[model samples]
Target chain A: MHLVLFILFGGLCVAGAVNLLLQRHPINSALSLIVVMTSLAVLYLLLGAEFLAAAQVIVYSGAIMVLFVFVIMLLNAGEEERTTGSKAAYLVGFPGAAALLGVLAFVFLSQKSALGNARLGSFLVTTSDLSRVLFRDLLLPFEVTSILILVAILGSVVLARKEQ
Target chain B: MNPLLTFLLLSILKVAVVLVIFLTAVAYTVLLERKVVGRIQNRWGPSRVGPFGLFQPLADGIKLFLKEDLMPTGVDRFLYLLAPMIALVAALLSIAVVPFGGGQTYKGVEIFDIADLNIGLLIILGITSIGVYGIALAGWSSNNKYSLLGSLRATAQVISYELALGLSLVGVVMRAGSLRLRDIVAVQSVHGMASWNVFGGFQFVAFFIYLMAAYAETNRAPFDLPEAETELTGGYHTEYSSMKFAMFFMAEYGNMIIVACVATLLFFGGATSPFGHLIPAFGGAIVQAILPVLWFVAKVLAFLFLYIWVRGTLPRFRYDQLMGFGWKFLLPLAIANIIVTSLVLAIHG
Candidate 1:
């Protein structure tokens, strides 16, 4: 029963994603992306990573998608420019995206059973565990990520200033 | 019915009851907010419906139902319809992961209470984030300049604060050593000198950051520039009316309640009694199981009252101030808190 719901939700997510990409209007695309994020949250629930699902919604849907919509709105590019992408861009981007998806699908299919072995269904990632991993095994990467975020902030501020 | 069938039925019934309670709570919460704000402002809120305007929400519901639910002619009809459902679903979904109470035994069979899941906390965060698209879509689909602007601001506010909010919890997660909400409470139950977490050195700082980030993430008062009525004219849902508008309102309050629940669970040893040692007589299995839940609810309600108080007292931040605070101030403080927490934990261990 759980798997059925997962599959149904996942299917909706994938369809929504494809539709999101196809939709010319930026708003439609943003809304569809939200759906995709939601379905992914559901998938996380089925996997028993409830926290991750919440983070997925709060982060991607709440934050990232909002950012996307904000940019679209800020740009003020309405329906007139929605479907104005070049045919060549579509031809190139679609196939490239498809190839990437195929590789991901192949990886996912091969590792499907192994994923269930992690016992993550009940494996809670507490604050301590996160710190241990972050500070120890992932220390360099963690620091690097922080630097990257700082740079992004700097760049956004600079860009906003340039616009002004 | 067979045992399995009976179990499923009972579970469904429980879920139904929870949903009904949440919806009714959402309705009454609106009424409560009006009354509270009115009393605070030295005015009577809604005294026309029933005694003290208790039935105002019901009256409002009827009025909304009777009113024409019209869609703008130029709008994309599908997305326009979908926005509220998305908001409502995302709003209500967070309740499932929240463990309202502890386990109860039946027939010598100990049933792990509160939808006992491994990653309950993560699920709550994930589902709540998805609600952002609802407002974004509503704004965009409405095809009104004000709506678009409102959603754009709201999305920015939610996302920026969300990062700080999630990162702020890393400190608690470090202390608790488990993602499960129950485990967090269990860990919080063991306190040292001074208060629970608010005085535990860097833990207190983390808690403060979490509190502020949560308020911003939920788009509550003093941080609610996105929906500032004077400026944006209703923000993202400027064009929405009837039940659709109600869904957005409910989602906002529901999200607030859930955030408060997370705060209680993480900081105050959710459901555990304060000074469990004092009550030596009641320190048996029953007390251990029951006290934490009471503690948890009390902690959550305290935060809820704080929310109301802030709403009553504080004025909304300017849009620039809001953004600047999150990026320039809160983000850096959160990072520092995370770094400081790890150092303390390392020394103690």
Candidate 2:
């Protein structure tokens, strides 16, 4: 059952991401992104990170992606405008992306021997567990991220204010 | 007799029962609203339908079902069709976590709710937040300016109020020390009516904030700027017709019912009667079992009545005013409530 769910949603996530990249219209792309995020959330649930799964849907898919969709709608962004780019750019970009993927995959495969296999219902990540980690071990980084968000909000408010 | 198969079957049975009851409740809620609002306006509403309009929802359903389903020119056909279904489905999904009655076991199976996740409240919040996409997509796909404008307003309104809604619940979560709806209600059961977060925990401010935010979240008056008939016609659903229109209507009322249920569970005593310990002597196992369910349903119904009452009594806010109230007033108030609640809990503990 777990394998089936993983295959189904993982395939969906990959398909959604590919569709997101291939979509011409901004709204279509946004919708594809939402699909990808939701599928990823389901994956998180499968991994037993229940709190993280809910947070992923609430913060990422629910709030951030909604903003993205709202902006796309407000701007009435149409199909991607075609533009000719330097051939060298794609040549470097595609190879660089592939190299990065290869390195990541190699690292994961190498570490597989060191890490224990994940069994269903073996590890449960609850809300209390998450909060304990965040508030104790990662308190400084969490506080810093919040401060960074506050700064960003202040900057946007200043930028958006009307001139006297 | 396989355990897994039994679990699946029971879950399916629970889902079917909840959906049927919920859809019927949503239909009757519409009738309740119309009748109450009509009386508020000095008129008899739907009396000719069937015995004080008890079957009015059935009549309305038939009318909607028989009506012509329209597809306007230049609309995004797929998305236009999908939006209402998405809205209704999202609305229905949130009810999976709500414990309508206290935990009860029949034949060694929990029967009160469908899925009782530890993070139930958050799951409901997450699912309901996704409901915005339905309205937003419906508006955009319609290829009508009025629809577009209405959806934009709805998106903004929902996002703004969602903050207040989530923050308002933080105090309740803090007091209960858990995100599970059952746990929250269990915490209240200790003191019965007074033990409610609203009364005993001094969360009246948070309760009020939640009430106001929930009203906005469900797109009820006086915060219903999204579908202001004076300005945007039918708003995001301007181009929808037939069962598609009914879907949006059902989704809205379903959301209202969910919000009311949540409010009752969180701030009221849920299935716990006010008498609490005193009620044991009144009757046997049957009364013990049925009384709490009656209390739970009664509280939810009262909240629905409150929803209709407010709709009848209050005037709609201006769009800008609604935004300002949610962001400026409700958000800060909710934040303050949380701070005060945490401090009190810390000192008292």
Candidate 3:
């Protein structure tokens, strides 16, 4: 069951991410990103990060992606204009991307012995467990991230405000 | 029986039952809304299709199914077709977590609900949030200016109100100390109606905030700016016809029922009868099993009536006014309620 679910959602996440890059229209890209986020959320659930999974869906796919879609609609963004690029650029980009993937794969494979297999129903992370860690161990980081968000909000408001 | 197989079979059975009852409830809610609104306007509502319009929903369903499914030119065929299904599915999915009554056993089999996850409330919030995409895509896919505008308004309105909705629920969760709907209800059931979060936890403020935000979340009257018929024609569903249009209607009513059920479970003692303590003599197994379910259904019905009553009474808010109310008024109020609740909880503890 675990292997089947991992394969299904992992494949979907990759497909969705590829679709996000391939889609010409901004709305289509936004929708693809939502699919990727949702698939990631399922993966999070499978790994026993239940709260994180819910937050991923609620905050990322729900709120953030809605804003992205809203902006795309408000701006009436159309399909991306295709442009021809130099052939040499593709040669360098493909090889560079492949090299990066290879390096990441090597790193993951090297660490595989240290990682535990995720068994279904073996671990369950509750909300209280998450809150305990956040409030006790990561309090400072949480506060700082919140403050950063506030600053971003203020900056957006100021930027969007009309001149008197 | 194998435990895993039993669990799967029971879950499938529960899902089937809940879907059947929920669809029927949604169909009747539409009838209820029309009849109530008609009476408020001093008109006799649809009495022609069976007694007191009881069969109106069935007749309407048949009509919609039989009608020509129109596909307008220039529409995004895939997304336009997919949108209503998204709305209806998300709306229906939220019902899985809602506990209709206390846990029960029949013939040595236990059933609490369809699937009561520990993080049930958050799951509902997550699913409902995704529901926004249905309206957004529907409007965008229709390729009509009116549809696009309506969906834009809907997406903005839903997102703004969703913050307040989630914030308002925080106080209830804090008081319960668990995310499970059944646990929240159990906390309130211990002390009966007086200890309900609405009355005892000083959550009247949160309850009111939730009520208003829920109105906007479900896009009901006064907050129904997305489909403001006078301004945006049919709004996000302007280009949809036949069964596709019916799907959107079912989705909206389903959402209303889900919100009402959530409010009841969180604030109104859920399936716990107010007189459960007083009537100890009548606490036979049959009475114990049946009364709570009746009480639960009663509370949900009352909330649904209130939804319809408000619809009949209030005029729709202007677009700017609606946004201002959600962000400027409800958001601050919800935040303040949280602070006050936390302070009180800390002092009491």
Candidate 4:
């Protein structure tokens, strides 16, 4: 049951993600991105990372997406046509897509080698254990990351301000 | 702790109770704000829809329920719908790791305590931090400039405050010497009311910073620049309506309660009474275990009331003021507190 559920959500997420590349409308792309996020959250649950799943839904699906939509509306890009990249854009994109697909196919074809021992993959970190890693071992990175965020915030505010 | 079984059951129950209480509180919080604000301005607050406007929130809820569910033309329909759910879910999920009660055991069957995950405090912070994505998504998907700005402001505010908020907790974590909220409370139980970390000089400064940043992180007043009514025009939820809007509002209050609960658990000692008096009086049997839970709830409610009181009393800060206070004031204060705490501990230990 869990495996089937995981597959279903995974498929939906993949489909939504692909749609983002193909869709012309920015708003539509934004909407599909949300689908991808929600589906990914579902996948997290199936993977037994319930806390992570919940966080994914809350952060990515909720606040992050909302910001994207807001930016879309704020820019008023509705009337504008989707930017068409030159042959150079596709030159870059197609190969990128192909490489991703190739890697995915290779993983699918060689599942045993790709996945390794099931037990190795099965190891799950409880929320508490993750917390310890974050608070103790990862303390410096965590603190630095927060400071980085503060800098980004100040920079954005400065950039967004109107000249006097 | 039955560990696994309690984890599952407690997760479900805590989510449900937090959801209901949070939703109800959101409804009343709106009404209370309106009424209180009205009184402040020499006007009656919600006097119409059911006795001193007690039914106001219900009326507002019904209106949101009955309103049309709008899916803007050409907008990202999926994301639009998902935004509110994300917000509500994120807001609600943080409550899980909060240790509301001590424990209840009867003949090998644990009755109440939620998952006794060893890292409860970390779980709470992780969940709350991730909850910001809901607000961010709401802004981006709406395709409205106002909403986008609101979301951005909210994101920046939350991310900024989250730093101070999380850093502020380091003192508590260090003092407790354990990341488990329950363990932290256990440590606090040693000193009783007088010595709760809130009173531990350096820890007290951290607590104040956390409290202020938490108000901002949760987007409460004086720091509610994202939803600044005068400029943003309802902010990120500008385009949101109906139950979706209701859910977002509930999520905000829910987040508020979660923060309050966490603050209580970390600093006040979860479920331990003002002086550990209740534990001895009740005896160390099941009842004694349960007393701590009651004390925890009472402490949490007190903080919630403080949230409301501040909302009632303070005027909202201007955007720059909000940012300056966070970066300039709270951030420095928190860093200093941490330094002081570390030095003191190092010297003493």
Q: How does model 3 score on DockQ?
A: 0.91
**Local distance difference test scores for all models:** 0.76, 0.91, 0.91, 0.76
Q: After superposition, how far is residue B161 of candidate 3 from its true place, in Å?
A: 0.6
The digit string of per-residue lDDT tens for model 4 on B1-349 reads: 5766865675676567756765776677677668766776778977988778899888887788999977655555767787788788877766656666655554443344445665566567656755676777688778787888898899878866777887898888777777677778777776578667887434788889989989998898878888988898999998988788888988887787788788887777667777655344745576667676678767877887788778878899877888888889988888888888888888996
* Per-model tally of clashing residue pairs: 25, 0, 0, 32
TM-score of 2: 0.97
Once fitted onto the true fold, the runs of candidate 1 whose alpha carbons sit more than 4 angstroms away are A1-10, A33-62, A79-164, B1-7, B47-52, B105-114, B191-195, B199-202, B280-295
| Pairs with steric clashes in candidate 2 | none
Whichever of 3 and 4 has more TM-score, that candidate is 3
Q: Kindly list the per-residue Cα lDDT of model 3 for residues B152-192, writing each as its tens digit.
A: 98999999999999999999999999999889998898768
Clashing pairs in 3: none
For residue B180, give model 4's deviation from the true position in Å: 2.5
TM-score for the first chain in candidate 4 comes to: 0.78
Per-residue lDDT over B1-349 for candidate 1, one digit per residue giving the tens place of the 0 to 100 score: 5767767666676678778876787787778788888889999999999898999989988887777676776776888988888887888887776766665655432233436566677666666666777877788789888888888787788788878887888888777767777776666555422335555434777788888988987778999877888988888888888777777888888887788878777776566566745556457887667765666667776888788888999998988899899899989999998898889889996
Worst 10 residues of 4 chain B by lDDT: B106-115
lDDT by residue (tens digit), candidate 2, B1-349: 8878888889899999999999999999999999999999999888888888799999999999999998899998888999999999999999898888868876566788888889999998998889999999999999999999999999999999999999999999999889999999999998677788789878899899999998998889998888999999979999999999999999999999999889988899787887657555467777777878889889999999999999999999988789889989999999999898899999997
**Candidate achieving higher DockQ, 1 or 2:** 2
Q: What TM value does the first chain of each candidate achieve?
A: 0.69, 0.90, 0.90, 0.78
Order of models, best DockQ first: 3, 2, 1, 4
Candidate 1, residue B314: CA error in Å? 1.6
Candidate 2 docking: what grade? high
